[model samples]
Target chain A: GDKVKQSPSALSLQEGTNSALRCNFSIAATTVQWFLQNPRGSLINLFYLVPGTKENGRLKSAFDSKESYSTLHIRDAQLEDSGTYFCAAPQGGSAKLIFGEGTKLTVSS
Target chain B: EAAVTQSPRNKVAVTGGKVTLSCNQTNNHNNMYWYRQDTGHGLRLIHYSYGAGSTEKGDIPDGYKASRPSQENFSLILELATPSQTSVYFCASGDAGGNGQLYFGEGSKLTVL
Candidate 1:
């Protein structure tokens, strides 16, 4: 069984629409981080949260340690936002992070 | 800018051959990690290091070995490459605490035949 699981393996959205991605953690996650892999296969860090919510431009992320889950919300999506999104959490008492399968997002104009 | 650089952006290897992926970080982070990404598996940690001379096994370290010789360099070695090892490898560096933000490299694409 996967320690970290992501929902909606794939998603499609219009250029100006909004969408949210979710991740469920079976491990005791104290903190969570979100990353976006662009078309060039480069991974970019989006947000790093500790059981709280953070907003950066059009992207907002929330992590709930008590519920063992996290959410990433994208507002007013753009073509540049079309990429694979991944959520990861640090392993208990270690620097290692376990990742979810990722959500492939496509923002079409 | 803080960066993590990986060599040989792409490589193709034969079975029973040796493959090495190297990572260098300019972030001065103490924690470094190597992870592999597959179609259904987003990213699984293969190995990690706390510092220059410390290496630790992650969730999936069976077919790979890792070395951290200095604060800025870490390497992943595959003694006997197999078809199952074909995937994109990523190296990341982070602060000492587990809750710090991580910086990842561009990734290395490896194909095994």
Candidate 2:
């Protein structure tokens, strides 16, 4: 059983459209973080949440510790948004962060 | 911004050969981790360390070994590289405690023939 699971393993969207990605946790996660891995394989941190929601520009994320789930929403998606998205959850009592398999997004004009 | 760098961005090794990947962090974080990414498995933890001279086994530690000789450096070694070990390896550093976020390097791509 995976501690963290991501839905819609892969997604495709037309530019300017909106989309959402989800992550479900089997473990008791205390904190969650989202990252976007560019084609070059460079991972850029998107959001870090304890609980509740946070928004930055066209991206927004929410984490519900009680439900053990997290969501990342992209608004007015652009071609540059094409890349792999990952969500990581920190173990309840450890400093380690468990990562989801990742969701690959391909946005085209 | 926290900086984490990995050396030998790409590597090629023959079966039964030795392979080592290195990671360094300028953030001076206390926790470091190693993970391998495969097609369907995602990112699987291989090893981690809390500080210099400390190494802990992660979810998938077999066939691999790790060394944390200093606070700024961590290395992953494969005594006998196999094709199965061929994948993209990632090194990350994080601050202490569960609330802190982890910062990652670009990654090292290894190919075993």
Give the per-residue lDDT digits (tens) of candidate 2, residues B1-113: 88999989999999999999999999889999999998888788999999999898888999999999999999999999999999999999998875688899999999999
lDDT (Cα, tens digit) per residue for candidate 1, span A1-109: 8899998899999999998999999999999999999999999999989988999999999999999999999999999999999999988858988889999999999
Residues A30-90 of candidate 2 have per-residue lDDT tens digits of 8899999899888899999989999999999999989989999999999999999999987
* lDDT at residue B6 of model 1 (Cα atoms): 97
RMSD list, candidates in order: 1.1, 1.0
Which residues of candidate 2, in runs, are more than 4 Å off?
none
TM-score of chain A of each: 0.98, 0.98
Residue B22 lDDT in candidate 2 = 99
Pick out the ten consecutive residues of candidate 2 chain A with the lowest summed lDDT: A89-98
